[model samples]
Target: MKKLLLTAGISALLATSAVAQTIGVSVARFDDNGLTIMRNGMTDHVDTLDGVDLQVEDAQDDVARQLDQINNFVASGVDAIIVNAVDTNATDAMSVAAASAGIPLVYVNRQPINMDTLPDGQAFVASNEVESGTLAAFQMCQDLRAQGKSGGAQAYMLMGQLSNQAAVQRSKDFHDVIGMDMCNFITLIDEQTANWSRDEAQDMMTNWISSGEPFDAVFANNDEMAIGAIQAMKASGLSMEEIVVGGVDATADALVAMQAGELDVTVFQDLAGQGAGSIDTALKLAAGEEVDKTVFIPFKLVTPENVADFLN
Candidate 1:
């Protein structure tokens, strides 16, 4: 009787272990501010679910590395794969790999060039880029008016990588909003890509400062570039009172700057929401459940007055 009981117990334990699911996550780069926050969210969600294992890999902003990681995941027979693509244009290879393996692919944070090309079991989760730029522009105009310098406020734009969709959409939307008669008082003095890097943005700002041109505001597509611009301005003996600086992502450093009156404005992208939503959708797909092709979280404006709400 004792031998029979031991055999039955072993069989049940093996059955339970076999039912556990495994998920694979590939990030564009773990060092990115927003992507780091998203990764935390993914980890938190995975911890809450029983019998679900998460395998995470970072592509370090390399397309080849991202593809290699995806291939490995496919070979491992993971139930689903999530990717924060390094380059939106290079998603075709990723999609083919996941689809060929009959696994669901969920793209988070950075969106692909064409959503329609995603296979039936694929999906995307991100906040709209347009809202970030539009809100920043609106806030800039408002701050300018409050300072009693409404008309003809000179502005400089610090762009991210031109190839990135978030950078493209944010730049376009800012221009569109500024083109409206309500914001026509603002004039763009110059624009250049900083490649979404703090050091690069600082170098660009240093050059612009050396040019001796006067600008009322500096708008960066992301917080890192904005913070870089601010550092440059500070080193050049320019104060926040002389120039309004704004950016997206509402990153922790940016929030601190806002509180200290160093940053003028920022647009808050829901990083946590995007992260959790991606994992939830991926898990559902893994379980053979249906999910929407895309999930969009909204962006909000964050200024000094409302910065505290987002700090924690």
Candidate 2:
């Protein structure tokens, strides 16, 4: 009887240990291409970790909804929380809530407006937006110059959501790079925000085509917008030979477009790296281990010549 009781106690303890390891993740929206890649990375890591349970919630691009989801995670006593914020500006409230509950918080993909305000158990994981934009700008200029159309060639920029930190940084970096003497020959004729929507970018590009403004190149902040611009340009009787186009995020669709000779260049953001980093950081924090306040995965430039390496 004594041996049986001891065995039962050990089983109960093991069950309690398994239940204690739970992580909650809140995504801004699952529909976004970049976020989708991140989600896959997160899912892959969760599958490998032992005794860790992960719960994911999609905020659908609503700040209030994201915050509420975080609150729910706190109430349920999750071991840690990973957030892909809808708005970086609202991170203060999120930080306060997570800190108050004594839960470690990890911000993935989208960065907050400021990281200084985060308490001890919070951190961020992503690539620098400046790197992606700078690489895209240099590649675009290189392609234009090679075609001998650098001087007096007009360029149009298709911006992502204006409020997103990545969009703002990428847009600023592109212009800053082009303003340099080497690329100054290229003129930015028109620029507009597509809010990172392929459909919206298509409509905007269609309007630009109807206006009859001659642009030699289109620089989109992401592959979705770049693909949209390509669709519009093709419908308007413009061929890839007549115009140069580039984008950030070497998503699968973008890579296909590049292979088909429809996209000239794209910058690769390491989706799997960021996703795995976020999960690792969250787990470390939960285990009372030290982690850097900000962790960055590097970005790479992808062109047809080297695109094959990134396809897998």
| Colliding pairs, model 2 | none
Off by over 4 Å in 1: none
Count of backbone clashes for each model? 0, 0
Question: Residue by residue across 1-312, what tens digits does model 1's lDDT show?
Answer: 999999999999999888888889999898888889999998898888888889999899898999999999999999889999888888999999999999999999888886887888899999888788999988988888888777579889999887678888889988997898888899998999998999999999999999998889999999999999999999999978878899999999999988888899999998988988998899888878888888999999999888989977
Report the Cα lDDT for residue 206, model 2.
96
State the C-alpha lDDT per candidate.
0.90, 0.92
Error of 1 at 94 (Å): 0.8
Model 2 agreement with the true structure over 87-192: per-residue lDDT tens digits: 9878989999999999999999888986877799999999988899999999999999999986668899999887788889999988997899889988998899
Off by over 4 Å in 2: 5-12, 15-20
